[model samples]
Each structure stands twice: as C-alpha cells, then as structure tokens.
Target chain A: MKKLMNVPNDVVDEMIEGYAAAYPQYVRICAENKRSVVSSKPVRPGKVGIVIGGGSGHEPAFMGLIGPGFADGAPVGNVFASPPPDPVLQVTKAVNGGAGVLYMYGNYAGDCMNFDMAAELAGMEGIRVETVLVTDDVASASKEEAHRRRGIAGGFLVFKAAGAAADKGYALDDVVRVAQKANASIRTMGVALSPCYVPQTGKPSFMLGDDEMEIGLGIHGEPGVKRGKLGTADEVADSLLSTITADMPLAAGDRVAVIVNGLGSTSQMELFIVFRRVARLLADLGVEIHRSFVGEFVTSLEMGGCSVSVMKLDDELAEMVDHPADTPLYVQK
Target chain B: MKKLMNVPNDVVDEMIEGYAAAYPQYVRICAENKRSVVSSKPVRPGKVGIVIGGGSGHEPAFMGLIGPGFADGAPVGNVFASPPPDPVLQVTKAVNGGAGVLYMYGNYAGDCMNFDMAAELAGMEGIRVETVLVTDDVASASKEEAHRRRGIAGGFLVFKAAGAAADKGYALDDVVRVAQKANASIRTMGVALSPCYVPQTGKPSFMLGDDEMEIGLGIHGEPGVKRGKLGTADEVADSLLSTITADMPLAAGDRVAVIVNGLGSTSQMELFIVFRRVARLLADLGVEIHRSFVGEFVTSLEMGGCSVSVMKLDDELAEMVDHPADTPLYVQK
Candidate 1:
C-alpha cells in the first residue's frame, strides 16, 4: 500500500511531536512523560480534572479534545494499541487540581486495563480518580448487555458531556454521573467500504471485495455484524439509523444530537449524503434533530466508511451539548 | 471505485441539502437559486459582502467557509466544474449590503468567466462588485507570471484574509486589496499519491504507478511538475517547503503561518509526520512559525496526497490570520 510516512515505528512519536508543535497554544507534552499531553490551560482549583486517551491512529479524538472547556490531558498510545500505565499516571498527576481526576475513554479491553491501573496508582497518592467507559456502539451487544458494547465514534458526544460538566466546576461524582448518562443515552453504527493499512506492518487491516461492505465494522477493522453487497448511500444510512433507533427506542417528539462521522478516506460529500438520508428518515419518524455534526470525528488510518451516532438529549444532556468548547479539532461559540 | 453514494447524479444536490439542513442556523439555500447558499445572518448594513464559490467536489472550501466572519455566500457547481452565472448572481444579490460585494475564489478559467459574468450582471443592478483570484500555487507559474498560477489549498489563507477584512467592515476595494496582497505573499504546492474519482462519470482523474507520486499536483488531479517513486515524508515535505521558500525567500527572523493540508485519503498520522519535518526544516532555517494548521482542508474526492502552504505574515496580514471565523468546517475565537 502507498503511504506518506517515514520510518513506521516512529510514526506515533513523530505524530505527537508534530501535533504538540502545531498547537502549543492549546497543548503541551508532559515534562515527566513524553507520551502524555496536558492542556496548555493550567489546572483550575475546585474543578474536576478531565483526562481522556486511547490509541494514536484516531486523530483529534482523545488528544484533539484537549483545550479550554475540554479534557485537561490525553495520554497517547501507539497506533491501535493502548498506552502503558506510566503515561496515564503522569497525565493524571499533571491535571489533578486537588478536587479529583476523571478518566474517560472508549470501552476497549486494553484501555480499561491501562486506565484502571493508573487510577489505582493515583489513589495511592491521595488523589481521587473516577472512570467512565464509553460503550455506545449498538452493534457490539444486545441492549440487555449494553455495558459490554464498544465505544467507537459515538464517544465524542459522551466526552463532550463529561468535559462540559467538568469545565463547569462540577464535582467528581457529578461529572461521572453526566458521562455515564450520556453513554447510556447514545447508540452508534458504522459501515466500512474499504480496508485500512497499519503503518508499522504496512499491511491491510481487513479486506473487502470491490462491491461489498461491512455493516457495523469496528474502528480497528474487526468483523462487523453483517457483510453484504455495497448498497446505495440511503440504504446504508437507513440501515444504520434503523438499528440504532430500534435499540434506543427513539420515538416521536424525542430530540437528539446526531453525528454523521466519516471513518477515514470517506469524503465530506459522502458524509453529507448519508446525513441527508438520515434527516429524511428521522423526519418520517417524527423525531427532532436538535443539532447535527457531519464530518470526520473518529478515524482508522484511511479506512473508507462512515458512522451515524445519535445521542438522545434530555434537558441536562441538551445543555451539555450546547456548551462552548475550544479545541484544535472542534470549536463552538 | 468504491464510493458511499446513491444515485451518483444526485450526489451534489443531496450533499448540499444535507449540509444546509445540518447548519440551518448558519446558512440557507437561496430561494431564487437552489445551488446558491447565503448566510442565515442577514446582510450587514455597511460590511463588504464576501462571496466565494467553485466546483462541488472541494468540500468545506467555498461552501463550508460560510458563517460569521467568513464568506457570506457560496454558489456551488457540479463535480470539478464551475457553477453557471445564475447561482453566482443569486449569491451576489443575497449578500450585497449597501456597501458592495467582494468575490474571491481560485484562479481557474471556468470560475473566472462565470464570476465575471455575475459581476457584470450585479453591476447593472447598481451593486458594485470586486474580484480577487487567488493564484498561490508556485509550481503552476513562475514569480514573473504568478497571476496565471492555479489556486490550490493555499486559497484558504487568502479567503481568510479577505473574509476577515470584509467582516471588519472594510470597503469592497479594501477587501480586494488584502485578498490580492495575500495571494501574492502566499505559496502552495501539493503532491498526489493516488487519483480521485468523479461521481458523475465514476472514473479516476489520473493514474499513478504502484509506488509513484506526482509532485505539485493540482486540486483537480491535473498533471504535476514532477512524477517519481514515492519518497519518505521528510523528503517530500523538504521538497515542497524548499520550493516554497525558494520562491518567497524566507529567511531568519521571518514569521509566517503554515498549513499542511491533506488532499483527501491521506490520514492525519501522515499529515502530522509531514508537519514534524516541516517544523524541523523551518526551525533549522531560523524562521519563526507564528501559527500552524495541519489537517484536511481542500479535498479532491478521495485522492491521497497533501499540500503545504506558507503565508508570510506582515502585521496587517497577521491580524487577519488571527481574526475570528465561525464556519462549519473552520472555527476560531
């Protein structure tokens, strides 16, 4: 596969260096651990610290979500791999302003293990730490076992809810409460039209025939719920929304914040087309779209596909959704 | 080519409909012309109206750049083709406050002819309009003939300068001056690792060998100045900045803004890797980078490549760069 990179092993380090260099006004690498990135904004007293992180390939996710009214820090990992406990500990210590620290990330096995270790280490230092696993992907498990689901791209909104609450000087318990609530009220599904390449191995992550697509494909290119001939944009969108609505039980008069996310390589034109069908389908269902975000939020190294995520917005969640944020990747006034 | 679109012929319309639907608070489709988009914010009484447009494939360019402190109107065209005079006229009328309107877009034959036609029509209607064609692609023309160069990703900075001026309530002629000045001070060059596909015909814009790349490729996947085997990220970035610095003669104590823009399918991992090298090269040259933007800005469907743009920031230009813009794709406070 053709890729624009130098030594593959250094891709992660170089990416962090470049990201920090490009936005020094927003973030800085932790002095203790190079892999950990702390917000340029200093830790505020009495405010709960928000820390997020995951594998490095998904640009502008955990790391990109660091700035004013966002995460206090992000401990980065290697491509498609979780960070070790040391960097996570460093990030937690750097962001702790005496109140406490809150840990948020996608619901992945490796992430859960590493973050749990860091939280244990922080507790030993007299700093309280809380954790919230974003499990929003509907395709990963049955609604009865929603806690076992994967996070995927829908975690953006979940993090938004937590970050907004934390930035508002909410207590540790309150921040954790809103994050868990956001996770519970969300569902996401994605379809992959093409495979991605792993930078280190220089190999395809998965394979798909020219006329095929995998519905509900995970961000890491894992197998999806269904594999079938590639359908039209509307068909694929309708399929994703139908599954999500069924699981979430959305109905008339229910309001939501919708995210039509490009996995990677999929253009904004395609994402908007997908959103067009989604809007039509939701209108037919009598549901109201209070806010719409259509773009590449989470990505898997040049994978071709899109994901649709819906966050049912109750009054509390709606306020969090409209809260202003200033980050390198996302901004609102 | 695998694409996530339905009824290829309706892709453009659907995309626009979805985009407007997604940001109704920011934009509205013109009642007179469906292809024209006007800012939902009514035309400011004394502010110079900023109108930008081109083809459909380049998302977030002319269309996505519509909102507060950005373009007030955008007239979209078919894939890689310029819009007709009707939409342009509609956008001109929609945005023309009592002061006047300023038209800014890339330097292309079709765009020039169509925009000039609209300007003439608007002139007859008693609305004074001025035009500034961005010609920042250094590889397309020499310094002596820079006006003939094709505008590529660097047009973002050019438009930003003009939009900021227009929103600052400058006269139409003053907005045109800064836009022209920005076009002259900026230099951009791109490389293509893969080809893009048009939905209408469903064919590749160009072809490259398995391990080859085209340097200085245009946004439309047009022929580049050089084609050779793919090089390392550092090597390619050095080549691009080397050429830009050569044209602009950057030196010690010089300050500027940098943009490392992904063409389409290029991932942020590769972009950051590229930016690391760019920052290194500029640092070695003793140049002070005032700001840096690294991500996908202007795209050609799903072409895999990137572009580097440098804008020498004088005090006047620096202020414009730091100004606020709240568009759907680009946002700053």
Candidate 2:
C-alpha cells in the first residue's frame, strides 16, 4: 500500500521523532536512544523508579500507560517485537532514583530474557534493579498452569496498580508485589479474525479463513486454542467471557472490572456490541462490575477481533483500581 | 457476518442493557430509556448537568465520554443514526438538576434539529436547557466558511473541556460557551480508505478503490471534499495536518495539541506512523505541541484510514485539556 513515509527503514526513527514532537509536554524521545519517557524530570533522593519495555504495536499497552502513576520510561521496540537490551538499560538508568529501579514487562520469552539481562546490566552499574512479569492470559493454559498462560490485556491492570503503588513511594519489592497481586486477580481470553503482518517480516503472523476466528491467539500471532466459524458479537462475548469467567470462576456477590478490547481492525461499535452482551451475561450471574472500559487496549497490529479481561476485585484491588492515575492511553480520577 | 446478537434490531438495546448491567457502580441507565448517568448519586442541587447524544456507532464518541466531570447523561441512538426525540428528552430531563441542562452534540443536521426540539420540549416542562454545537472538521469546509464543517474527531476536545467545566459547576450558558470555545479553537481533517456498512442498512455507507481515500468524510458516511489515490502515512498526515494547521493558522513558537485518530479498521501502528510524521512536520514549522493522543477516537464503523485533529491551545484550553476527567472513551488528569 502507498504510504507517506520517506522509506521503510526510516519509519521507526521518524515515528519516534514525531511522537516526541506531538507530546513534548507529556513525553520525549531519549536523545541517546529511541526510548520514550515522561517530560517531567524524574525525581531523585531515593525512591523506586519503574521502567516498562515491549514492542510498539500494543498501544496504551506499554507506551500509552507511561506517565505519573505508571512507568518512568517506556522503551518501544519495533512493531510487535521486543526492544533491544540497550534501550531497556538506557531507560532503567535514566529513571532510577537514588533508591533503585524496577522493571515490569510481559512474559514473552524474548522480553523476559532481554529485560532480565538489562536489569542485570543496570545492577552492574550500581543501580538496584528488579523485575516483575505479567502472565494473565487464561486461555493459554489450564487453571493449574495459570503461570504459563501468555500475558495479554491484563497487563494494564498490573501496570496501573503497580504504578500507583510506586508513585506513592512504595519500595521496589512492595510495588512488584502489588503488581503481581493485580496480575493474579485478572485473566484474559482473545479471538482473532485476521492476521496482522509484521513490518519487518512483511507477512501475517497467522492466517484464518474469512469466515472463521482463532480463539486464544497470542498477541504475537501464535496459534489459538480453537478455530471456529465467526460468531455474533454476543456469541463471541459469551465464548470469550465464559472462557475467562470459567477459568477464573467467580461466585455470586463478587465485584469485577471488564475491559472489552478490540485487537486492531474491529470498530468500537463491534466492541460495544460485545460489551452489551458481556454485561448482560455478568449480570445474569449476579456479578457486580465496578468499572468498565471498551476500546482497543492491547491490539495486535491490524488484526481483527477482541479480548475480554475480567479482574475479580476485593477492597484492596478496588481501591487500587479506583486510585487516581495519569497516562497517555488511560486515566481515572 | 454471523454475530452473537439475538437479532440485528435488538443489538443496540441489548448493548445498552449490557452497559448498564456492567457499570452499575460508575453509571446507571434511566428507567426504560437509552440514557445513562454517572452514579454520583444525589447530584449536588442546581448543578448544570451536561448531556451529549449521537448515534451509538461512534463507540466512545458521545456515550464513551459520559462519566463524572464530563457528561451526566449520554443518550445513545442507533448505529450511525441520531437518537430519536424521546430519548433525547428523557436524557435531558433525567440529568437536569434544577440548575439547567447544557446539550452538547456534533453538528449533524438531524441531531441538531432533534436535540433543539428536545431542548424546547424540556424547556416547556420548566427545565432550563441550552445547546452548544461542535463544528471542528476543517476539511469539510473552505476557510471562508469553516463554521459549516461537520464535527469529526475534534469533538473530543469539546466533550473533555466542557465536561471538566461543568464538573467545576459552570452554569449552563458558561458550559455551552466553554464547549463552543474549545470547538472554535479546534479543527479536524479525516480520510477514509474503505466505507463501513451500517447494520441497519446492511450495506457500505460509501465505496472507494483499494488505492483511494476519501478526505473530509462525515461520520455518518457523508461525502468528503476530496478523494484521491491512497497515500503513505506521511502523505496522508501532510495533507490532513497542513489543512488543519493552515485553517487554524498557528504562529511560530505557538503551542498546540494533536490527536491522530484511526477511522476504525486502520492499525494503531499506522496512526502512530502518521503521528510521528505530523509531529516532525509541526516541529519543523516551529510549533510546540503540549499534548498528543493517537487512537481510534471517532470512527466510521470499520473504515480504514485516519484523521488528524489540532486544537490551538492557550492557557484556558490547555488547563481544560489537562483537567481531570474520566469517561469510558477518553480520560485526562
């Protein structure tokens, strides 16, 4: 397809330059690297700083959530691919206060290995660094194997609570624990209508018939748990919600938050249609929903379809969820 | 396409039922009506409640912006169609706090006339009502007649600042003035790659070649001012941003905000690609961007392509832009 770019190779650099230009008040591109950070200068004098790194495509996922009460820096990689360790290290060092730094990222193998290496490298520089991984995609594993499920949209909740805790001056381990607590209480299930082509690869991550959808697909285009005929918004919601709820198993009188997220190509109308059904299904089961958001949260390039995320809430989780936050992708008062 | 709906006609209502069912804590639907109010129960007396309405297809557009400090009641209509007069009246009456109601909506003729009539009907019932129309789509009109342009993605700024002002307890007239001022300072330009089908019509709203784009198209599938071969992300941003900047005429050293929005089917990567370029171009022109957002804000169902919105910012606009507000669709703190 014709595009306005100077060339394919310059796409990433130029894109970063543009992002820095548009959001100069909220963020800036590190002059030393392509990583992004809040424009507000990071504070020093011994406070834990949080840094999150990942590929660029899952917006509001990694980059969109960077700001106060969130990440100090977000090093964006190429589309749907992990960033190099160099940028991660750069972000960690830049955001590390006198106390230490903590790194949070998805459970992707490349991300886990690379970020861990970055954290180790930062430690070598006398910067105390720690890491927490989010793994909340219930469809990727059985309940007994929840730890093995691929991380999906639930990472936002982890990021939000953890960022708030960190912002409130929690120590590195406490922030990590709160984030993990949020992660443990959440689960996600997703379906894909079409495959998203990686720019570097110039090919779809996967393929399905026009009349079908792949359920339980990873954001990286990995195969889903099931490939079935395309269903209505209600059925899609039922299928995804049932999988998420069944995997989580919330009983009556439980309060939860729902996120009906579009992968990429689905419209908000389509997402709302799904939300309409999911809301009804939850109500019929006597579940109380505290907060609800429907949009493209963790998208897979231009892949069609959506994922449902339900975070079973308790008083602590509810308080953390309702806490004030400021981020490019989402915010709450 | 097969959907999870009980029936196509029941889709919108079912979705409303689902929304009310799920977000009972944050919002509640009016009895037997399509309107919803943020559950800050026992709204302070004499508070000027903001009411916004539009067809529901825009996802977070009118409805998504409903929440504390933004809109009190969002009366959603059908897919890409205006809410009928009854819901408009009910929503206005339901959210009116003895203070008076400020009706905010896009500048579509049907919506304007319907909402105007509703205001009159509500006024007849001794409820004070005022209306402010948002007209920020610069691409649809020549500079000489810019006020005639339709409201596109730029309407978000109006919803945001107005909601913030109303939450601060502005009177109905002042709230309308703030929204109008924001709308006046903003201009948007959108291009469509593919037309989306309205389920009610069961057909494409418009058509285009794979290599073409329709610039300045209305949200309801209205024709744009120009249609041409599809361009690169940079080229699209150049055309859209240049038109927006020129229409608003930003001075050197002036600060502004940019919103690069996807028209549904476009990828977030594509929007970012465009955002990167637009930011660079604006920087080159000596404009300082204070804030920026990239996502699917106002969409045309599943249409491909994106829109660029620029709001020339001053202290008031900037403060309002930075004010704390929350809604299902957009948020700021």
Candidate 3:
C-alpha cells in the first residue's frame, strides 16, 4: 500500500497534528508528552473530568466525541493499537479539573493494562482517578458469558450516558454506574464479508470468498463463530438478533433503540436492508423502538458486513439516547 | 455481489418503512404518498424551510440531514434515483413556513429537472422557492467549467452551511447565497477501487480488475475520468487534491474544511491513511484547516475506494460552517 508519509512511524503523529489543527476550536492539546486533546474550555472547576482513549481508526468515537458532555480529553493511539501509558497520564493530568479524572475506553487487554498503568502513575501524583471499560459486542464471547464480548459499537452509548452523568454533576461512582448500565443493556453482533488490510502489513487480515460470509466476526478481523454461504437480509438479521435477544430478551411492550452498524465495508443500503428486518422482527415480537440509527458507527477497517446493536432502554436510557448531542460522530434531538 | 434482500424491487420501500418506523419522532408521511422529516420542533412561522432530496441509498445525506438547523425535510426516491415531484412538492408545502423553501441537492440531471419542476409547481401555490444545485466534484469537470461537475462529498459542506443559514433566519435569497458560496468554493474527487453491483441489476456498475482503480468516479457508479493501477493513500490524495486545488486554489493563508469520505467499502483505517496524507499535504501547502471530517458520507453501495473534499472558507463562510447545526447526518458546534 502506497502512503503519503515521510515514513510509516510518522503516520499517526501527522494525522494527530492535522486533527488538532482542524478542530482547535473544539479541542486543544497539552504541552505534555502523550498527545491529548483537552476541551477548549473546561466545564467547571473542581469537577471530575472524563478521559477516553483507544485506537485511532475509529474516527468520531475517540476523537470526534471529545467535547462538552463527552470526553474532556482523548489520547488517541495509532490504528488498532492502544496508546502508551505516557499519553494516558498526560491526558489525565491535563483534564484533571481539580476534582479527578475518569478513564473510559473499550475492554481491550492492551488498553486495560496501559490505562491501568497510567491511572497508577496519575494517582501517585495525587490526582484521583477511576476507570470503566466498555464491553458491549456480545459476539466476542459466548451468550453465557456476554461480559467477555469485546466492546464494539456500544462504546458510544456508554460515552453518552456516562458523559451526561458527569456533566450533570454526578460523582465518579454514579457516572460509572451509568456507563455500566448502558453497557449491560447494549448488545452487538457483527458479520464480515471482507477483510481490511492494515497499512503497515499491506495484506488483508482475513479473507471471504464471494459467496461466503463469516457471522459473529470481531471488529479487529478475529475469526467469527460461524462462516457459511451468504444468506438473505431477514436470515442475517434473524441470525444476529436471535443471539442478542437470547442474551437480552426484550419482553413485549419493551422499548429499545436499534443500531444496524456497518463494519466498515458494508453499504448503508445493506445495513438498512438488515435494519428493515430488524425493525419488523422487533415489532412482531411487540417491542417498541424509541430511536434508531443505521450506519457505519463502529467499524472494522474496510471489512464487509455489519453488526446489529439493540440498547434496551428505560425512560432514563431513552432520554439520554434522545438527548441533543453535538459531536462530529452523532447528533440527536 | 451478495445482498441481504429477498427481492431487489422491494428493497427501497422496505427500507423506507423501517426508516419511518425507526425515526417516527423525526419523520412523517403525507397522505401515504410522501415521506418527510422535521428538523425543528414547533415550526417557527415564516421561517425559511430548507428541503433536500435525492435517491434513497445515500442514507443520511438526502434524508439524514433532516433535523434542527439543517434540513426540514428530505424526500427520497429509489436507490440511485431521483424522488418524484409529488413528494418534493409535499415536503416543500409542509415546511413552507411562509418564508419559502430552499431546495438544495446534488447536480444530477434528474434531480435538477425534477426539483425545478417542483419549485415551479410550489410557486404556483404561493410558495417562494429558490434552488441551489451542488456542483463540487472538481474531478468530473474541467477547471474552467467546474460548475458542471457532479456533486459528491462536497454536498455535506453546502448542506451544513445552508442549514446554519436557515437557522439564523436568513431570507430565501440569502440562504441561496450561502449554498451557492459553498458550492462554488467546495471541490471533491473520488476513486473507485472495485465496482459495485446494483441490487436490481445483480451486476457490476462498472468493471475493474483487482489491481486497478478508477479515479474521479461518480457516486452513482459512473465511470471515472481515469483508470489505472491501484496506488497508495498518498498517491491517491495527491491526485485528487491537486485537481481540487487547481480548480479551487488554496493559498498559504486560506482556511478550509476537509472531508475524507469512503465511497463505500473503504475502511476508516484506509480513510485515515488518506486523511493523513491530505492533512500533511495541505499543511505543506500552508493552508489553514478549520475542521475536518473523515468517514463514509456519501457511498456507492459496497464499492471500495475513497473521495476527498475541500471547502475554502472566507469570514462569512467560516462563521456559517462553524455555527451550530444538528441533523441526523452531521452535527457540529
């Protein structure tokens, strides 16, 4: 793969510089070692600050949502790679807000270890800190142990509810509770029709024949639970949603928000086709949809196929879901 | 070429039904013939209503931007097809608000004629209508005749600015001015790495080998101006940006917003790789970037490749672009 960089090592740095320059009005970086974009203006003095970090390829998730009512700071790592603890510490220190800092991100092993190290370092500096790892992609693990499902699309929902909780002056534990609740209620399953090529590798992570699809694929191109001849939209929707429903059954009259997220390479038309079946199936099961979004929300780089995420909502979750959010990633009213 | 639909012909309608059902709070139907979405609540009497429409497959574009400060209504047609005049007229009539409706969309010939006809019909009903067709695809037309270029990702910039202008209570002509300014200054160029298979056709829209890419391709699967071996992110960005800058010169001190959009199957990683090049190139050129968004904006089914868009900004354009706008498609502060 041809790239437009001085070298492969400079790619992430250059991208960050451009992103910082472009969104200066909304974000600013600390002079510290780890690259971090703090809110242009802090929310309040002596308030708990939220810092979210992860790999860089998922635009709008770790970067675009860095503003008020979201992350106070985001220390973005390179493509699919977690940032070092140094950057995490720098970002936490910059957005301390005098009260504390909350570290939130996906439940990746690399990320967990690095952020934990960063938290320990920050704590030594007398900065109070807490952490919540979002684990929402149910397909990553078995139904009996859904918590082990790697976090995928539900990162946004956790960020929204927790960010709002933080913005509403909730304490650190309360904010964590909101995020945990959102994560627990949210379930996602994905399929991969094609694989994405890592820039450094220049080779596809996986392969799928023209007539085949791997259901329950991981966002990072990990092997799925099943691979078979491609099925119809209804069948795919049923296959994916059945697992999600079995894990989190929405009783009749239950209200939920659905997200048919394209895993990078899938088209919106295909996502919506599956969404059509999802909506029909949910309605036939007597579930009421509050608000739904179908798009490439969380994605595996260039992978073909999509994931369906249903967030079982109560009045609180519904309000937060409907709350007006002004991020480059998503805006809802 | 695999699809999820049971039948190709019913795909569009089924998708619409799901869209309406999923987003009832944001959409409404008129007499069971027209589909529309409300951008703001408690419609402000005499406010200039902004209406945009196009084909259905371009989710969040023709329809997704319908929300506060952006588009009031978006009526979609079949996939990659223009909406009929009745729904256009109905959306215009429903959101007239006495100030008139500003019809904005891409510069496709079908859309141009049908929206023009709708404007004429709406005018006969005492509704003042002005239209601005986006011609921002610099690669498709010669520099001297860039206005004839087909609209692509650049439509997002124009839609955003017009949405903000309408929110500020700009009169019909003034809103038209913003849209025109955005269209004139914005430029986009796309390349397709693989051909897309239309659902109804079950065949490739265009043909290309595994090692090839078609540069400057249209979003509707139209052939690009050039076909050559697939190249690097830097090479692709340089080719697309050079054409855009040559057509819409970006001087040392000029501020602009950039959009690195996936044509469809391109991953965020690849898009970021492209954005990495684009940002560095613009920086080397000494251009100021006000904002940058990279993702799947306007897509062509599941075709792999990407497009780059740049919108030059003056003081007026910058303010409008920076202004608060909310839509299902995009949101900004």
Q: Interface RMSD for each candidate model?
A: 0.8, 2.8, 3.1
Candidate 1 or 3, higher lDDT? 1
The DockQ score of candidate 1 comes to 0.84
Candidate ranking (lDDT, best to worst): 1, 3, 2
Docking class of 1: high
For model 3, which pairs clash?
A2-B232, A233-B4, A302-B267, B39-B67, B60-B64
List, residue by residue over B69-132, the lDDT tens digit for candidate 3: 7788887888888887888888888788999889888988899988888899998999999999
- What's the chain B TM-score of candidate 3? 0.96
Candidate 2 per-residue lDDT over residues A1-333, each given as its tens digit: 323345666666666666655555557777677665444565555667878768877866776666777777888887667888888888877787877887877888889878888888988999988777888898777889777767888887777778888888888888878888888899888888877766666667777885788988888766688899887777788888888877789887999988887787777666767888787788799998888877777877777788899998888778777777776667666
Which model, 1 or 2, shows the larger DockQ?
1
Q: What does candidate 1's lDDT look like per residue over A1-333, in tens digits?
A: 888888888998888999999999999999899999999878888889999998988877879889877788999999888999999999999999999999998889999999999999999999999999999899989989988998899889999989999888889999999999999998999999988888878788878899999988888866578898999999999999999989988889999999999878999999999999999999988999999999988888899999999999999999999899999888887
Q: Rank the candidates by DockQ, best first.
A: 1, 2, 3
Using TM-score as the yardstick, the better of models 2 and 3 is 2
lDDT of 1: 0.90
Best prediction by DockQ: 1
Stretches of candidate 1 above 4 Å error?
none
